[model samples]
Target: DQQVKQNSPSLSVQEGRISILNCDYTNSMFDYFLWYKKYPAEGPTFLISISSIKDKNEDGRFTVFLNKSAKHLSLHIVPSQPGDSAVYFCAASNQGGKLIFGQGTELSVKP
Candidate 1:
């Protein structure tokens, strides 16, 4: 089954603190991974991505790590900001074009 699971429905962190989000998948064929950050009434924007070939990927304050063997992945946000408050979706696709996404993790940055 092509299922990406975000165990947590939501997360809250103080501003400037680190926020961690977890995700798991059942599909072994999933080789390419991506994280998308979305605000309300908008489409998901690509945050970071890692291929099955690489274990980690990072951009600015956002980082994503993948463990192929464990079928797990996580996203870490450093120095979380109030602007960062939004839904984060972890997506995976073996074919590289189409993606399967988790329900979502809503991140709230408290001031």
Candidate 2:
């Protein structure tokens, strides 16, 4: 069974607004959670990450929140811009260095 899951396949937001993406996981052993943004023809680039010890982590306009007890996580983008439009994937890794990714959620920012 897939350990990571993204329930929404896509999300749309107005520029300058906030975009929220949701992800869930079944594995409790995951210690690291990451979000990656991917363009159409290029590889995914790391966005933000949160360790199990922290409830939240922020970087510029991106923020990642983790709820260890619920096995859920989310990414929030404030003042979302057009350039932020891309596929976002949630990844989880145990101490083994192997990552499990959820099906990506495509984000569209409207101008």
Highest-TM-score candidate: 2
lDDT of all predictions? 0.93, 0.96
Model 1 Cα lDDT, one tens digit per residue, 1-111: 539999899999999999999999999999899899999999889889999998888899998999988999999999899999999999999794999999999999999
The candidate maximizing lDDT is 2
Q: Residues 37-95, candidate 2, lDDT per residue (tens digit)?
A: 99999999988889999999999999999999999999999999999999999999998
Reference-based TM-score, model 1: 0.95
- After superposition, candidate 2 runs with Cα above 4 Å error: none
Candidate 1 stretches greater than 4 Å from native? none
Worst 10 residues of 1 by lDDT: 1-10
RMSD of each: 1.2, 0.6
Clashing pairs in 1: none
